[model samples]
Target chain A: MEIKENKKDAVLLLELKGRLDASTSPKFQKKILSVIEGGEKNLVIDFSDLDYISSAGLRVLLLGAKKLQSVDGKIVLACLADHVKEVFDIAGFSVIFPFYDATEDAIKSFE
Target chain B: MHPSELIETNLYREKERTLFYGFIWSAVFLLPKTVAVVLSNSVVLLADLLKSISKCIASLASWLSIRRVAKGKDFSYNFGYGKLENLTSLVLAGVLIISLLVIGYEVYHRFLHPEHIHDFGVWFGLLIVAAKFVIDVYFWHHDRHLAKIDNSPIMVSHWKFYRADAIANGVVILSLIISVVFKNISGIKYVDPIGSIIIAGFLLSSAYGIVSKSLYDLLDGTLEESLQLVILRELAAFFDDYKEFHGIRSRRSGSHLFIDIFLEFDNEKKMGEIYQTIEKIRRRIEKSIPGSNVTITPTRIPFV
Candidate 1:
C-alpha cells in the first residue's frame, strides 16, 4: 500500500492507493496519528484509488475518528472507490464518518 | 472479480448503453416526429409528439438520477443523494401533469370547434407508429432485463413509460384510420381529439403513479413489510446475545438499506463480548438484506 500526504490550508489530505489490510493498517494508523500529533486537526482521507479494505483498515479509521472527536477536531473521507464504500457501508462506518464525493468538498466542510 | 463487482460493472455498462440509445432516439427519431406534428396539425399527431417529448425528458431525468446516486454522501447531504432519484421522478410527474393539461385543453377546444386536419399524412403517421412500436419493444425487453438484474425503480418506470407510449401510439393510429375510413361521417371528426384525450388520460395516470411513489420515498417510508420481516427474523437468532432489543428502524434509499438497531446488552457481559454480539447481529442482518448498513446502539435502559 502507498500513502500520499499533502497539507493545504491546515487541512491534511491523506490519499491511500492499493489494498488496505491487516498487513498495512498499522502503518496507516501510525502515519495518521503522527499528523494528529503534529497539531493538525482537520483531516481528509481520499480513497478514490483504494482497491480493497479489511476490518483492520476500518479499525484504524474508527480510532482516528474517535481521537479527532476527543480534541474537537474532525476527519472526513472523500472520493471512496465503490468497493471500499461498500465495505464502509457493510461495517456501518458510514454512520460514524462524514464522507464527501471530492477532496475539495471535504476540505470545504472544515471551513 | 467478486460477484458484487461484476454486478456493478454490468450496471454501469448498461446505464451508459441505455443513455446512448436514448440520445440517439431523441435526436434522430423525435426531431422528425416533431416536424411531422407541425406539418399535419392533427390532434393524434400532437399527442404522439407529446408522448415522445415526455419519454425524452424521462430518459434525461433517469440519467441524472443515476449520476447523483453515484456521487454518494457529502457533509451537507449526509444521508447521500439517493433521494435525487425520487426528486427527479417527482419533477417528471409535474411535467407530465402540465403536458396533460395542455393536451386536455386542446382536446376540449377541438370538441367544441372541430377543424379539418390538413395534410393528415396517413403514411407518415403509419411510419411513426411502426417506428415507435419497434423502439418500444426493444426498450421494453432491454429495460425489463436490466430491471430484473438491478431491481431499480427508475428502470421499471422507464419500461412502464415505453409500454404506455406504445399503446398510446396504437390508439393514435386507430384514430387516424377512423378519420381516413369515415371521411364523410361528421361524428368521425371527433375521433382524433377523443384519441388525444385518451392519451392524456394515460399520461395523467402514470404521472399519478410517479408522484405517489416519489412522495412516499421522500417521506422516508420504511422498507417493504416482507423485507422488514426478513431482518426481524435474522435478529431473532441472536435473542440470547442481548437482554432486549427495540427501536429496530429500517428504511431504503434507492437500492441501499439503512437499519438502526437499539439493544440493551446483558450488564454481566464484558466489553469485548458486547462488541462481538453487536457485530454478530449486524452481520446477520446484513447477510439477510444485502447492501444494508446496520448500526447497533447499546442502550443502558431496557424498554418496558
Candidate 2:
C-alpha cells in the first residue's frame, strides 16, 4: 500500500492507495504512528484509493485512534470507496471514526 | 430465564434425533442378528452380531447424552451440559474398542479353523442387515448435514460413527455374500474372516477419530484468533466510548461462545451513556458472531 502524506491546514492528511491488509498494515502502522509521534495531532486518513481491509488493518486503525485519543487530538476518515466503506460498516468501525464523503470534509472537521 | 439468554442452537436436538434413529434402527436388527450368531458357526454372522450390539449401545449412549444436554441446562452447570456429550462419546469409543477386540478374536479363530456351516436363519439375518445398511446411509448423510451446521463435538462424533457404520455394513454384506453364495469357490471361505477383519479396522479407525476429537474439545482453551479480531473490531469502532484496551477473555461451551471484554470508561461519563455503550458493543459482537454472548465491563483495573 502507498501512503501519501501531507498537511491540509492544521490537519495531517494521509491518503492510502492499494489494499491495507495484514501484509501492508505494519508499514501503514509505522508511518501513521510516526506521523502522530512527530506531533501532528489532527489526522485524516483518506481511503479513496484503498480497496480492502482485513482485521489486522483494523487493529492498527484502533491503535492510532487510541493514541490520538490519549492526547486531546482526534482522527477521522475520508473518501472511502463503496466496498471499503462496507467493511467498516460491518465491523462497526464506522461509528468509531468520523467518516466524510471527501478528504476536504474530513480536514474541515478539524478546522 | 429470559428468552434472549437461551441459546438458539440445534446442537442438541438434531444430534439427539440422529442418535435416536440409529438406536431404533439397530434395535430393529439386534435380535435377529443375535439369533443368527447363535444358530450358525459362520465368522461373518458373529462379526455382524457384534457390530449390531455395539451399534445399539453406541447409539443409546449418544442419544442419552444429547437428551441430557438438550434438557439439562441448569444453573448448577455454569457452562451448560456440553461436556457431557464429549464424555458419552468417549464411552462409546470404549464400546467400539471392546467390540474391536471381540471381533479380532473371532476373526483370528476363523482364520485358523475355517468353519463353513451356515443356516437359513443366518440368511434371513443377512437380509435384515442389508435393510439396516440403507438406514445407516440415511443416518450418515443426516448426521453429516447436522455436523456441518452444528460443528459441536457430539454431532461430529455421531457423524463419524454413522459413516464408519455405513462402510462396515457394506463390508459385512460382502462377507455374507461370499459365505452364503460363493462358498464353492476354492479359497472363498477365508474371505469371510478377512471381511470381518476389515470391519474391525473401520471400528478401530472410528474409535480413534472420536477419541482424538473429543479429547481435543475437552481440552480446548480460549477464543480463536479470527474471533478475537472480531471483538477487537467492535472495540476499535467504538474506541471513544471507553478508556484503556485492557483485555478480552473468551471460551466455548458446547456450541456457545462466552466473551468478556474489559475496558475503562471515563470517570465523568454518565451511567446511562455507559450502559448504552456497553449494550451497543455487546449487541454488535453478538450479532456478528452467532451463538455468542458478549459482555463489556467498565472498570479501572485491567482484567483478562
Q: What are the candidates' C-alpha RMSDs?
A: 18.5, 7.4
The digit string of per-residue lDDT tens for model 2 on A1-111 reads 899998877889898999988689879988977998999889999888888887668767876777688788888998888887877776678777899998888888887
State how far residue B183 of model 1 sits from its true place (Å). 3.1
Q: Candidate 2 at A97: error in angstroms? A: 15
Instruction: Report the C-alpha lDDT of model 1 over B1-304, residue by residue, as the tens digit.
Output: 9998677757856865786576468556777787677766788788778777777887887786786666544578756476776777787787788788779878888989997665456657767777877887788788877766665667767777777877887888788777777778878778889889889888988888888877876788767655655654554455446654444566766656788777776678898999998898888887877667899999864222
Model 2 Cα shift for residue B260 (angstroms): 2.6
DockQ of each: 0.01, 0.21
Quote each prediction's TM-score. Answer: 0.65, 0.65
In model 1, state the lDDT of residue B4. 80
Candidate 1 lDDT, A1-111, residue by residue in tens? 999999989799999999998689879988977998899899999998898887657757755664576578878999988877877766656766799999999999988
Worst lDDT 10-window in candidate 2 chain B: B2-11
Q: Best-fitting candidate, measured by TM-score? A: 1
Could you give candidate 2's per-residue lDDT for residues B237-289 as a string of tens digits?
67777865655677777766789877778878899998999999899999878
> Any residue pairs clashing in model 2, and if so which?
none
Q: Return the TM-scores of chain A for each candidate in numbered order.
A: 0.96, 0.95
Itemize residue pairs with steric clashes in candidate 1: none
lDDT, residue A109, model 2: 89
